[model samples]
Target: MLFNASQQWEKCVKQIEERDRLIFVSVYVLIFVAGLILNLIALVVFFFHTKTRSHTTVYMTNLAFADLCLVCTLPVRICYHLGVSLHQRLCEAMGMILLINMYGSIFLLSCTSVDRCVAVCFPMSSRVREVRKKAPFICLGVWIMTVGASLPIYFIKPQLPGYQNQSKCFGSFPVYGTRPVAITSSLTVGFGVPLLAMLVSSWGLLRAIKRSQAAQTDLVDSRKIQRMIAMCLVIFLCCFLPYHLSLLLVYLHQRSIPCSLTSSYNYSLMVACLNAMLDPLAYYFTTETFRKKVDLDALRQMWPMQSQSQSADHHSRGPLNT
Candidate 1:
């Protein structure tokens, strides 16, 4: 009986390891490539090709920048999995950076949704200019808040028992212990609140759009509102939901639940990375000026000449669009 029980335990462990290997090799590879490419293109277009400097532009640009920062942290993760040497401090730092950008993206996404909701529901409000002017300040606050939230990593010593040489800095968290508090806090602030804000804003936007359509709004503007609502739903459902569900499973696992759900957590994290890739699609759909036709490749190819020409054009056209 004892011999048979040992065999069964070993089989279960082997299956988990095998499943995790497949997830890391397949899903993470797709995330790394697609996320990097899409985010880079978005940053380039937002930084260079776009002529408008509106509030939406500011929010989207910062969101893209945050996604790009998160994407930059993936190579370090891949290297750690591939047996590359990483100092403990470096590992901890990378973990903190990942959390910072993850929460930063969450807050920025919420801000964008709120901005759209206000714009649609109260377009003629006297405070429109005041709200628009606060966007940069709001972005700065998000950065500071996220950075402060991530600072606990500097003080918490990672406890990786038996596998001291392994680079599982964030992976070795004790589910039922202090780690759960951190994870719960992160999920609550980073995922839960933002998701609620998005849903409320999306519903508000939908009502506004419906009223406008009833009043015979422009076809173009109606389409933009519909697209924006769809994008927010996709981001919440496809990207954020799976990861947070996995975290819940981790909590259960910590409580001695004999489930094998932990092996799938990394796959959900990869799915979360898809949001970094998909956000540019949201930008393309939501904003009128962002959808304006511009040759990004041509602009990059002729950057030096184009910079001079655009400078002349800026002056000729009389001030940057704001």
Candidate 2:
């Protein structure tokens, strides 16, 4: 009887493992394709549309650049998951690159939100131009900060257990009797501080927009600005907040939780992959330039026929038609 029960448990575990493997493969592929395509389009559009290049465009450009960097790191992760043979050192390097890009992108998005808020609140200030001019410096600072924050991962050696004859790259930290201070510190600095900043900046943007609306001046522009701000805030909240919260919880769990909780943590990590794909859609739908580009592309498609019809109409008319 005990043998039969054990067999049944083993069968259940196998089924669960198979399901998780399938889920991971499907989600990662979708994230890779969608993230790469959308961000590429964003980069192209932002780069070519000179008229669209404003202070906000500068922020969006930096955000897109950061997201592109993040997408570049996905294939390594996909390969790792697919049972590819990778050294532990390689894994740590890939993990560090991923961390830097992810946190950097989030920070840039927060900066974008703050920039929009300032633009909305103080439209006439000369500081708007200053903000636009200094964007390059801000972007440089974001990159430096992200890289600096992620530097510690390079020093640790991560090992993959349970994989036979395969080296796995993961973040190695000193385990102090079930306590992981290094991991906790990394999460706090990378995800926690950035998330808090995003929330605060988003809140300030929302409040400023509300105040402007109540003032009954620049109503149309204010409405448009409000829509844009709301869309950005929604994307940040829906796509990112849960991911960071999950990381925080996982960090706390690692200190005193059972290994069984890792399945839930992995699920949360997977959900975070959705953000990269969703961000491009948010920009496309909210930004006026994208709409105008779409409109022009649609118009160009009809222009040849419209021109031919007009020419025929002119030929058919008498001289008096002039």
Candidate 3:
């Protein structure tokens, strides 16, 4: 009976290992391909389209740029997962870039939500436009804050436990213990505060829109803004909430959980990767300019052929004058 129980345990371990390997590979590949494609489209459209070059688009463009930076780091992760020797220096570089992009995107998204809320709530004041004029400066400030928040990782060296001759890299706060104060400080400032700001701004915008005596055009715009806010909130809840929750859980469970529960850790990693895919969809659905650009591009593609067919039909007819 003891021998049979041992065999069952071994089988379960093997199965979990195999499942984790497959999930890791799939998550990375999907995130790399999908993130690159969608963000590239967003970047190009926002860059070239005159109509999309608005205050909102400025924020979105920055967001796309950050996401692109994040996607660019995936190949290094792919290499690491495939058992390639990741040098400590390379890991540090990758970690810095990842943190910069991740926090930058989050901060910019919160800013975007705030900008939209102000616009919807006070269209008459022109204060929103004034703020929009300074968006570039605001974005620069956000970048600085994000980079500063991520600086602790560059300073603290993190080692991989139970892996012989493995590379050590930058560490999260609880993982490295070099800057627990800094890490906690950053998590609250960088993530928690921004999340709260976004929530409050969006809620205010929704309430303002609901109360306004809207024209037909204003009503349409309000609905669109509402949808955008909803999408942003959903993205926040789905993508970011899990990763933070997992961080809290891991910190709490460090001593209680067994080392054999590696699957849970890997699953948390997979959930984080889902954000890369979900972000593009949020941008596509929420941003009116993105949809308009897509629609215009489609029309432009069809217009020439449509005009040529009409001309051909006209030429085929006998002369009306004769």
TM-score of each: 0.76, 0.71, 0.74
Who is ahead in lDDT, 2 or 3?
3
- Could you give the candidate ranking by lDDT, starting with the highest? 1, 3, 2
Model 1 poorest ten-residue lDDT run? 293-302
Summing lDDT over every window of 10 consecutive residues in candidate 2, give the lowest-scoring window. 293-302
Cα lDDT, all candidates: 0.64, 0.59, 0.62
Cα deviation at 297, candidate 3, in Å, is 28
Candidate 2, residue 275: how far the Cα is off, in Å: 1.4
Judge candidate 1 at residue 32 and give its lDDT: 70
On lDDT, the stronger of 1 and 2 is 1
**Which candidate should be chosen as best, given TM-score against the real structure?**
1
Tens digits of per-residue lDDT, candidate 2, 187-246, equal: 576566766766676676556545432324432344565566667667766666665565
